[model samples]
Target: MTTSSMKRSQPFRSLVNRLLDHGILPTRKLILLLAGGSVAAALGALAGLGYALFWLYNAFLLLASILDWRSMPRRGQVNVARILPEQTDIGRELTVSLVLENHSGQPVPYRLRDDLPFSFERPPDVAGVLSAKREIVTYVTKGSERGLYTFSHLYLRCQGRLGLWEKQAKLAYEQHIKVYPDLSTVRGYLQSLQESLIVDGKKFLLKTRSGTEFHAIREYVPDDDPRYINWSASARGRRLMTNEYRPEQGKVLTILLDCGRMMGVELDGRTKLDLSMEAALTLAAVALRQGDQVALLAYSHEIKTYVPPGRGLGHLHTLIEAVYDLQSDFVESNPLLALEYLHRQQKRRSLMVLFSDMENYLLEDQLGAYLWRLRRSHLLLLLSLADPLLHDWSRTAASNSRIAYVKALAQRFQLDRKAFQQKMTGAGIQVLDIPADQLTLTVVNSYLEIKSREAL
Candidate 1:
């Protein structure tokens, strides 16, 4: 039989092997017994036989420890299983349980330490006595990174009945868990959107001249668009009436996530890519809820993942699963390649939002033409994370020559960024350079604005 099979079927035999191969450890009680023996030996020395008494007591202590070690239940007599959540958000605490079953016909005192990934917070060691058929122990731990993690062997130490020795055994219980990006803001955004719609018991109409679909006819207000005045309704009602139109639903929203080397740069403990993922998922959730199809394209040197446009709230889960474990590649990204692939896959006019580094895009002079051409058929919006450090540098006073040089460079970069923004605006491409913390909210708002304007 295989090693694991042997362990499962012949636990007693495995315990026997462990008993012979593994050394017995002294418990606190055993050490106390040894200390008492020493005291007794010292007293015997007062009676003029210290060495003999010491040897005699040592032999008795050794015998008692051996018996204690052998009295403990075998490995086959106990079973252990670990329970973990299949998925969790990064930095969120999750409970881990260890269910232990003992069939040794007696109580077993155990100390357990699970083998966990190094990236996770250290878990507390569990110690308990199992007197019943089943005993459960739980602890809380959180993962710091986003990826799949494994829990392999669990080290179990069982104390003898006399509490003189502990026999250690390794239980093979493996479990997999996936950690996803923190999406705590998604619910808040949805709640805010819902609240925004209900003001004084009236649903706020998103009035826009660009909306083409007819919705309802309402009494004309002072600021109502003159172009939407329904002449027939106004004449029949003998009052001025205006036509209402809601933004088109089932529109397409494409999110392009850049996973290049530059995206690996960390700001405020989170990488740029990490922040982008959070924003991307939030945007996707908002778009899906609005009855729009959402697609994702994560690329570095090559496309890491591509999820075709799909509708419904369930599609958010698919997008989360697709990019939960995606990492920033060491190589630079090819935005053109990703866009080309997306163009072929998505022929319909869609809103394309690119989350990438501004500096990288600036380096690719030819990329502007491609984005401009794509804008002819699609609504293009480029979002980049603005580093706060550069902003601070640009605002710092020139206290030294080195400081002046750095400030000059920061100012130059800012100027270039503004120039690029203006150039893109002239070419009908929207651009936003925002801080990481505000990226999600800005992206969602920008999308809403585009939809209201019927930009797509």
Candidate 2:
């Protein structure tokens, strides 16, 4: 019977040995206690206090064994659930809720470190509460890139009352969040304009030759169409006047985002490329709502993402999904190559908005040649994000050597930017230098102004 019992216990002993090998067993603390007891026993023997040392050694061993046995079982398991926003806009603070639940019957104390995506992180000095189930809310400003992001892991550290050791685990849950471009300014502008137009008593008319959709008709003045003269209305009226109409549908606008090394310069809390992407998306959303087809292209050294021009609600989703994971490349962007790619992909003439910084020195020599070619095929509008910090530094009085150096650099860069704008404009290209905060609004307004003039 004793041999059979030993054979059965062999597997259990092996399992415990494996656990000890992984440091999951409290071997170090137990070993330290035993070593202390041995030292005490030796010192007591030298001092002729053998009985006292023997009792002390046994008591130390008993305490260490009991503590190790108590620590063998895990305290509890923690599960976390994250509630994220369905859709968020750029430059806006969005709130995400996290709920942590303790699964053990015994009360468990845990500290949590929520893992946010690279673009989003909790502000400093944030803390989570301890409870069976507690909700922790945090906020992050949406980035300019439009796309879906998955945040899945929650890093946790739990410890018992002893506090000498901790159990670490990663509690994971999947969440999909969609980020949309900043469109509040554009939407507000469009709605205000529409309201103004309605209030002005300027009849909404659709031109058959221009737009795809038909708007209401009004009395014609000079050069009225003879064919459009309503015979029945003429019979009822004293004189005949032709009916006039304006185009109801808007034009197609495509925004090409340059995700290249030049665009990777940091402005505010994000990259310049990201600001441009947000501006492009805002323009796209406004155009879509105004009954126009919108498309997007994210290109660096190569074409990253592309969404074909289309109208309606579905197109928004299609465009957002396409440009979400766009990262800037270290290599210089080939404008000639990008334009050529676009020309081949897009057969129709489009109002192409390009969001990229033009370094004057580089462009005056190389990119100038490509700009002339690009302008010939498409109605091109160039928009770039101006670094606000540089602008501030340029205006501030230099107080010290470091400040003077920074101001000098800022002035030089500003001069280069201004010179580039002039050269581009001289080439018959329209340009807009917008600050990060005002990028979306400025781009939207530019598009609206272009539409008002029927430039496209």
lDDT of each: 0.87, 0.67
Cα TM-score of candidate 2 = 0.64
Model 2 per-residue lDDT tens digits across residues 355-414: 887552245366666767777767888887776777899988989999999999999888
After superposition, which runs of candidate 1 have C-alpha atoms over 4 Å from their true positions?
1-23, 28-47, 189-210, 214-244
RMSD of each: 5.7, 9.4
What TM-score would candidate 1 get against the native?
Answer: 0.85
Worst-scoring 10-residue span by lDDT in model 2: 197-206
Q: Which ten residues in a row have the lowest lDDT in candidate 1?
A: 198-207
lDDT of 1 by residue, 281-387 (tens): 98898788778999999999899999999999889889999999999999988999999999999999999999999988899878999998899889999999997
For candidate 1, the lDDT comes to 0.87
